[model samples]
Target: MIRLAVVGVGKMGLSHLSILGAHPQVRIEAVCDTSGYLLDVLGKYTGVTGYSDYEKMLERADLDAVVIATPTRAHATMVRAALERGLHVFCEKPLTLRSEDSEALARLAEERGLHCQVGYHNRFVAAFSEVKRLLELGAIGEVTHALAEAYGPVVLRPKGGTWRSRSAEGGGCLYDYAAHPLDLLAWYLGEPRAVGGTVMGRIFSADTEDEVYSTLFYPGGASAQLSVNWSDESFRKMTTRITLTGTAGRIVVDRQECQVYLRDTAVPPEGYHHGWNVRYTTELTPPVWFYLRGEEYSAEWAYFVDAVAGEPADGAAAGVNSFASAAVTDRVIEMLVADAAVPCGVAAASGTGASGAGVSGAAGAGPGSRGARKRAFWSLGKLRGE
Candidate 1:
């Protein structure tokens, strides 16, 4: 059995603990968090050791892997400590608030041959997974344009916001909410060449943007638009969707289903037809050992467990949801951040009557300058590797 520990028994952490606790190949080694009461309660009832101090737990616990569900600010240090201890790590999403930190951790994990998985659970969603498959099968050949969106009722009438609303702590619609679709965009299309028309607006939260909108320019004439709003009460919960239009066909997908349309010239995949095909997520998803918030949640953990057990990944088409991929998503966020810093383009702002022209002189990152930044980002060695 693989010895495992869980840090930060928060909502997501507890869910992971519950799911992994039922895994036949995993042994609960220790649990750590700042709450002594929670630790005592767990230790007393669960027959598992608990510690209030993370460092102390790291020093005392014997483990093969760790699932870190700590706050965003604490992730870099905690993950570094775990990696230094020669333990594989499973970290919650947006691997780090900074791209450089994520790149560093990914490099360290690569050098050590340790599996470091990020918790981008949507990748495990069957409909989303099918998008990856269909794309690989050339169902939608040579995508020309795409739309990625995520909406939620998160910050409708924000009171004192939690760590999620603070930009410094990796909160905000851009990082906390938009990261979901942004990561999906990165997975579907490669890293964007540049970003423009970015609007990081705050609806209720004072510290961070409650909504995000941006345009991502990709290579080979393909482009994408990102639209996200966490303050949208129209959606009861967070909803993510992607729409792709290609030379051969089009695809639109959400958690529930994947809709595809193929041109007559396009050759359909095995189960798909030339006109239109719809595949529900329920039919695409396989059963998981433990069900939590969704099968995607447990499915992600199962992927991590299999990685720790040295099993081959689901397939190269599914891709490895590692720190490397998260870093790419971070870089895309960084691009959007830089783009939003430049003043919005208004026709009245310039005599040329061009809306694309911004007010900033040399201080702003425009399309040309941002593409150079993307080149530097892509220059990083094997940022897409295992």
Candidate 2:
């Protein structure tokens, strides 16, 4: 069994605890959180030890891996501490508030030979996973454009908020919501060369954005648009979808299903016709030992457990959403945040050509350029008033 410690016990954290507690190959070693009341309750019922101090927990617990579901601000420190203890880590999305930190953490984990995955669980979702498979199979030949969108009812009214509503904490709509589609975009396409026309709109929240809109330009002339709004009441829950247009056909996939349309000249994959076809998620999703909000939840944990156990079975094929991949997404988020701060108007006024200011400079830098990695520092410094 992979002895694991679960940190944080909030909404997403509690969900992870419940799912992982039922995992057949996992033994819950301990849980750590700041809330003693929540910890005491979990201990009384679940029979797992609990701790209020994270450092204390790390010092005493027998752990092979740690699943960290803390706030974005807490991730870098917590993950680094756990890695120093030589424990594998599964952290939540937007690995850290900054791409540089996420990249550094990725390198640290690699040096220690530990598995460090991020909770971009959309990668485990059947429809989204199918999209990746199809793209790999060239079912949609040479993707030309993609539109990734997400909508939910998160911040609809003005009120005092938790860490989620604060830009310095949870990163608001752009990080909390937009990161999902952004990660998927990076997974399907490579790192974006540049970001443009990024907009962060504040509908209800005073501190951070409620809606996010941006465009990502890729190296091969392909492009993607991101549209995310957390203030939409029409969605009963968060709904993320992606539309891909390629040379041969187009694919539209959401949590529920994948829709495909192919031109007459394109050759269809097996079981797919040379026209419109639909595949439900149930058919594509492999069965899980336990079910929760969705199979993807258990599926991701299962993948992590297998990886930690050093058993490369079917799980290895899907590929874990490693910290490395999350870094790519994080850098893209930084570019978006920097782009939203100052768009083409500011860039044009500053004689920086009209793409944007800092982001345009970042875009102009080669993907591997030092400027690309260091350009966002100025915008972040400006955001922090440093």
Candidate 3:
């Protein structure tokens, strides 16, 4: 069995512990948190050592790996410390709020040959996995264009108040929630070639944007439009959908049921397109829940366990949630910030027509501290060029 230590006893961290408990091959060795009350409460059921200091837990526990679920700003330092000590890491999303730090951690993990998994869990949802397969089988002949949107409450608190509201803490909905759609799109299509968007801080008092709608043009003339909002209600009201248009047929996966549809035709085709036609032709069916639901967390954990054990078998293919992908998301967030000030495709005063500013900083450093602050350093030449 692989021994594990969970850092941070928040809801997410607790969820990880509970999910892993069901896996027979895993054992929870320790639970660490700064809250003494929380640590004591969780320690009772976990039956593991508890520590308010993560460093103390790491030094004392002879464990196989650690789950870093702390605040976004602390990801880089904590993840690096674990990998340097030869422990595999499973961290939550945005990997790091900044690109540079994420790059550094990726390099460090590669150098040490450690397994690092980020939190973009939607990749594991069976609905998406099936969508990827159907696309591979040419069910949706070459995807012409796609659009993804995730609108809900702003998960971040204000910098002075909570973690979700501050740009410095990576609190915006773009990084926290929309990350699923971004990663999903990138997975279905290829890497995004160009990304530009507009962010509006409409309702929220926090510094970062509460709503963002973006357009990403992919290679091969394919493009994707993304709309994400914290102010709207989407979870229970409208399910997430991915519409893929192709020459042969079009596939739609309503977070409810993964379904397929073809332009109405009298003659039926053969081979792979068999069972799915009747419903699309007849009437709308109930949404399909593709994943095992319970397996969402276990699948990821199992992959991490097997990968760390070195008995590898398509483990990486299961969806790594690497730092690089998080960097891409970071770039999109930066583009939104830059685009907010200046319209996309418009040439600035510098005579050169650069679209937006490239906010560079250490990965996982958070937005306000890096991207927001970096924009302040650029002069007219730099700004116009940016």
lDDT of each: 0.85, 0.87, 0.67
- What TM-score should be assigned to candidate 1? 0.90
Each prediction's TM-score versus the true structure: 0.90, 0.89, 0.78
How far does residue 124 in candidate 2 sit from its true spot (Å)? 0.5
For model 3, the superposed segments whose C-alpha errors exceed 4 Å read 153-160, 237-239, 263-294, 314-319, 343-386
Candidate 3's TM-score: 0.78
Best by TM-score: 1
The predicted structure with the larger lDDT, 2 or 3, is 2
Q: After superposition, how far is residue 364 of candidate 2 from its true place, in Å?
A: 17
Q: Predictions ranked by lDDT, top down?
A: 2, 1, 3
lDDT per residue as tens, model 3, 251-280:
666444466665444123343343354223
How many clashing residue pairs appear in each of the predictions shown? 0, 0, 16
lDDT score for candidate 3 against the true structure: 0.67
